[model samples]
Target: MTHRTQLNQAEEHLRRSRENLPVAAQLLYAVADLLVDAQPAEPVTNRVAGLAFTYAGLAVLAQYPQAVQDAALDRALAVVPEARPSETGGEWALRLRAAAGSVR
Candidate 1:
């Protein structure tokens, strides 16, 4: 391949990688938040919708999840325009320890 073509390919790969990162971080923390700490079945539909919204938002912003691909980016973007990463290794750590204790 020409140098120009190689550069384009590398740029595309970097674009996709940057787009995907915050999405994954948001999702891991969201699942950890709802499933790990709270009882999700209490409100039923609303709680489920909240989870779905979270996933949709992340996929729209990050483009990582396969399910979001099926629904298309527009659908995901309809609920939330963007997603951001969660806070880590701070006061939140204390809350988790209080709830479930340490793995190590």
Candidate 2:
């Protein structure tokens, strides 16, 4: 499948399965979807989007019942220190941590 098609599928899956996920997981997935959906064109925008995607995905994965390897969370944790405050002064890393903590 084309890259855009794959992204669309992933977004649809997230939307359909969201109710089954913890609130935090849903939020993180939403962030991931948004980052990919933007289809960033600039180099810097692309880099930021890639980081957001990895951070969001890893945060969600770390919340799973059986939880993936510690390396996933470690990578996600590494991304947090690089996060800059959003234009509205919100912190994405904090939101990600809250979501990871919310997993059952």
Candidate 3:
């Protein structure tokens, strides 16, 4: 399957597992691992960052340890470009940053 397809499946799993924190966290971690392995390009990187941000937020909501949340946020931030030209990309990066701040 394509990376996009895999990412979509992982995201679907994450959403479906929301009521089960352990499952959701596992899926989120899987998604993060996929993103890391893919090493996606510009616009795709933006999407990956958004997914990571969501994972971090879910980690916080699920009462995960601070280190886990920080790691998720760090992975998200690490993928974001220092300068994204697309408005949507910039917006997603900003949202991720905001989510990171709130998680801490």
Q: Highest TM-score: give the candidate number.
A: 2
The local distance difference test score of model 2 is 0.50
Overall local distance difference test of candidate 3: 0.49
Candidate order, lDDT descending: 2, 3, 1
Measured against the true structure, the TM-scores of the candidates, in listed sequence, are 0.23, 0.33, 0.29
Candidate 3: deviation at residue 43, Å? 14
Tens-digit lDDT track for model 2 on 1-104?
89999989996875776757654455455554455444323223436656666665565565555444345445444433343434111344344445544554
Off by over 4 Å in 3: 1-14, 17-62, 89-104
- By TM-score rank, best first, the candidates go 2, 3, 1
Question: Candidate 3 on 6-49: residue-level lDDT in tens?
Answer: 99999788566544443333434444444444443345455665
Per-residue error for 92 in candidate 2, Å, reads 11
- Per-residue lDDT for 6-27 in model 1, tens only? 9899967755654444343333
Comparing 1 with 3 on TM-score, the higher-scoring candidate is 3
Give the lDDT of residue 27 in candidate 3.
Answer: 34
